[model samples]
Target: MTSIALIEAAAQRLAGPARRTPLLSSPFLDEIAGRRVLVKPECLQHTGSFKFRGGWSAVSALDPEVRARGVIAFSSGNHAQGVAAAAKGHGVPSVIIMPSDAPQLKIANTRALGAEVVLYDRANEDRDALGAKLAGERGLTLIKPFDEPQVIAGQGTTGLEIAEQAAEEGVSRADVLVCCGGGGLTSGIALALEAKAPGLRARPVEPEGFDDVARSLAAGLIQRNPRLSGSICDAIITPQPGDITFPIMQRLCGPGLAVSEEEALRAMALAFLRLKIVIEPGGAVALAAALFRPEAVEGDAVIAVASGGNVDAGMFCEALERFGG
Candidate 1:
């Protein structure tokens, strides 16, 4: 099926479960950018992120036998919660491998959803190797965090919703900005928008230090960064985009953009203070791109996907201070 058809199916399947998060207009941002700016607040979604849409989609597509056997996945944070929550909803067992340094709230939430949590040192251990071993030993179906087609289709639901909402608001075409990690979210958004709003431009935004998607798109090939540097947006600080996701992005998305940690922090704070919404650093990257690089989005009514809201209280406070709020 075409990517748009896949996204439509996902949206239909997930409609009953996934929250219809609001398309909130940001006057402050619109004034700053000299155009209309809307935020797709997926932070308000179940499990506090857009990942829930893809997780549910993937879990629902599993064979009955596989669901009976359960599933396994590896994630730094949001996807762990997504897999765990989705598996729980389907009455399936899930095991999630996470970096030892992953946020405490993410680990707690994953366990709370009844998933067994295995922690490995991200800087020193291969989480995929550990996850694969556990899945094999336990006879569980492996659910890759972002690389799989099912996961990508599931993520596309976010784009479908955005397009529909914008159309209802009388927007003919707009630049849709999405945050990128392994590229599932951005690719999904691109595919959905391309299908639903033919002329709309989709752009992937990444952290400055973790610009794998940007570099890969520029080189017209998948490129891996040997190491990931620091970013306030830890959720999107993946070393590279997924192989499957990279191709889709290269075809559908505009050139990727990278925003600084300071820009991300400011965007997050802006969402909380001005928009009265909670947004994690990764989710705020799109808004940061709109704010810091207006030239890229100028003259277009832009929709920035605020992908998640899960954040530590300490970090949220620090972000506000950094944003000069």
Candidate 2:
């Protein structure tokens, strides 16, 4: 389990490497949401995602000899790039197992970051089995996307920042909406809020039809998504909330929120226009909930974590074309 102490240690390890992303706000966004909306743009983070913090934390926390043996991770895109970049920075080897249908830009970026990229059929192949085989053959430590203790601790560092930033902004209370997949980011933030910002609450946001975390939170139990591969918000798609993360969320988070893919795209368009930042569909879900689903959120303000920006040009253009007003 990830505790505040572990998160502090991860923050220490990440002090020099991870970017402390800013909390941005725009009057235009405020008008749309009918609340003061602050966005924590992790899209501007290293490797174009907040996943880098988790990747670097996990890799750096390993024993030096163990880290020297290399690391492996399974992600459709963002986490893969995060791990690959972190491994390269540490002068260690990395192998990324990604779905074949994952965005080409992510796969290409992973390879360019000096990792071996293995593509699998998402519908037919077992990614975990393949990752285990590779890790065994190469004596590599597996860096799980969200389920690992170190990874969750790394993600929690973002919540620590949110706590501090909200304090700076004089926001004693608000909902911190985070894009959710296997619940790593949301649970991490929830933990940080529990420890450091009792007045602030964390909420998980998901794309519709792939809202396992939202449904699970509503049910007070783990629930599975019926489909995993079809959403345009691919970065936040997972079969269910992670076993390690769900309980943390249950204990600390507010009710989860789900938004449509079109809403996510609209959020992407708005983020670009108002904040001048690019956001992928998955990363925009929290912003979507904040902007389009204001009634479901509480408080006079809301903070949304724009989690990643590793989007393909075509998809990004499509979003801008459709909703870039």
Candidate 3:
């Protein structure tokens, strides 16, 4: 269980290492959403995602002896880069098992960060088994991408910052939209908001085909995505919500909202054009919901966490070309 105390502890550990991403706003986006919109560009964070906060929290919190043995994690891209960089900064070895089909930039970045990159077939293989095998063989700690208490606590630090930043911006009541996958970031933010910014609510946003969190929240039960891959928002696609994270979201978070792939791309282009930030598809989903699903959201203002920016050149060019107006 990740509580405010745990999150505060993680924040203490992440104090100097992780960047405190700014909460930005664009008049253009505000006009489109028909309300004030604030964007938390975690894309500007280390490793190009907010995952670094969790990565540094998890890696740094480890006992010195265990951390020295190294760590391993499995991610499509963002989390892989985060953990790899954290491990590198900590002067420990890391092994990242990424999907073979993940963006080339993420794979290359992970390797550049000094992690052993192992590509796996996301559809046919189980990352848990592979990660376990590798950890056992190399005496490495397995830092799960989500569903871990420490990781969630680390991510919850974002919520803490949002609470503070929103206050500074005079945003006391608004929907804090977060991009959802295994529910790590969403759930973590929800917990933090509940404690630090009760007036501000956290909501999970997902891509249309992979709306497991939305459906699961509506149905009051866990739901799985039929397909494993094939969306441009690969960074935030997961089979289902995590057992640990789902309940927290269900309790503390608002109803989940989902948008289309096109909507995500459009939001990406808009972010690039207005905020001058490059947001990947998965990372753009929250902003997509804020812009395209305005009726589904509440309040006079909305805050979207631009979760990542580890996009490839071709896809980024496509987004800018098709929707960059």
Error of 2 at 28 (Å): 1.0
User: lDDT ranking from best to worst?
Assistant: 2, 3, 1
**Tens digits of per-residue lDDT for model 3 on 46-145?**
9899899889989998999999999998776788888998999999999998879876776878899999999889799998899889999889998888
lDDT of 2 by residue, 154-244 (tens): 9999999999999999998999999999988898888888999999999999998988998998999999999877899988898999999
What's each prediction's clash count?
0, 0, 0
* After superposition, candidate 1 runs with Cα above 4 Å error: 121-126
For candidate 1, list the clashing residue pairs, or say none: none
Q: Candidate 2 lDDT (Cα, whole model)?
A: 0.93
| CA lDDT scores, all candidates in order | 0.84, 0.93, 0.92
Instruction: State the lDDT of candidate 1 residue by residue for 218-261, as single tens digits.
Output: 99988886677666787887878888888888888888888888
Model 2 worst lDDT run, 10 consecutive residues: 99-108
For all predictions, the C-alpha RMSD in Å is 1.8, 1.4, 1.6
